[model samples]
Target: MPHVSLHTPIGDVTVFEHDGAIVALDWGWVEDQAQTALLDRARQQLDAYFDGALRTFDLPLAPVGTPYRRAVWDALCTIPYGETRTYIDIARIAGGSPRSVGQANGRNPIPLIIPCHRVVATGHLGGYSGGEGLPTKRWLLALEQPEGALL
Candidate 1:
């Protein structure tokens, strides 16, 4: 596995690569760093995303998970940038209950690229397990929010 750490507005994040595909994006820096072309590209994409210059990610992702969880993550990816969907909405698409969808969302290995933050509760912001938790989720949603728009 190869990984690279970079600084971002929210905090320091390390992108992990396994078998040439992005495997995880973890919070904070890791002492053991291995730079690869894919990791460098991932960093560039992440930088563009944080700068609000990129709306979609073009990278190969290989998150390790069960089939149902993969379905949930795939559904999460369908959520467009600057838009949000409810757990129920994902459940409808992924063939699971809202709770199950949320569970899978929490376990997502690749967070920002998978766009898990785009999935919110029906009437409110949901729990987030990445970065600094809810604050990070709020920041990400705000970043995606169009100018003069309220999230």
Candidate 2:
């Protein structure tokens, strides 16, 4: 597995690749294993995204999951950065039930890159696996919202 780690607004991110396509994005300082040019480029793109200079990702992705989970993650990739959607909304879009959508969301291996943090509940911010917990989730949401939009 080729991996690269870089800094982001939320925390350090580690990107993993398999079969020439991105597979996972986790939060942590990367270990000193081997690196590749593709990993470097992925790190650069992630940095640009955290700096608000990029709104879309252009890397090849090969996330491993079931057909339903892949469909959920694919739909998640289509979610614009800084935008929040309810689980029910994603369920409707993914042609699954709300509970199933939540399960997929929880199983998301790529967080910031695939933007799983963008999904929220109807009345509140939902769960997160990243640093600072729910506060981090709220910050990401606020970062995408217009000034003074945070409550």
Model 1 lDDT per residue over 10-82, tens place: 9999999999999999999998899999999999999999999999999999999999999999999889999
Residue 71 lDDT (model 2): 90
What is the TM-score of each predicted model, taking all chains together?
0.98, 0.90
Which ten residues in a row are the worst by lDDT in model 2?
A: 142-151
Clashing residue pairs in candidate 1 are none
For residues 84-130, what per-residue lDDT tens digits would candidate 2 score against the true structure?
Answer: 78888888888798778878888888777778888888898778777
Residue 99, model 1, lDDT? 97
Q: What is the lDDT of residue 100 in candidate 2?
A: 89
69 Cα displacement, candidate 1 (Å) = 0.3
What's the lDDT of the predicted structure labeled candidate 2? 0.80
Predicted model with the maximum lDDT: 1
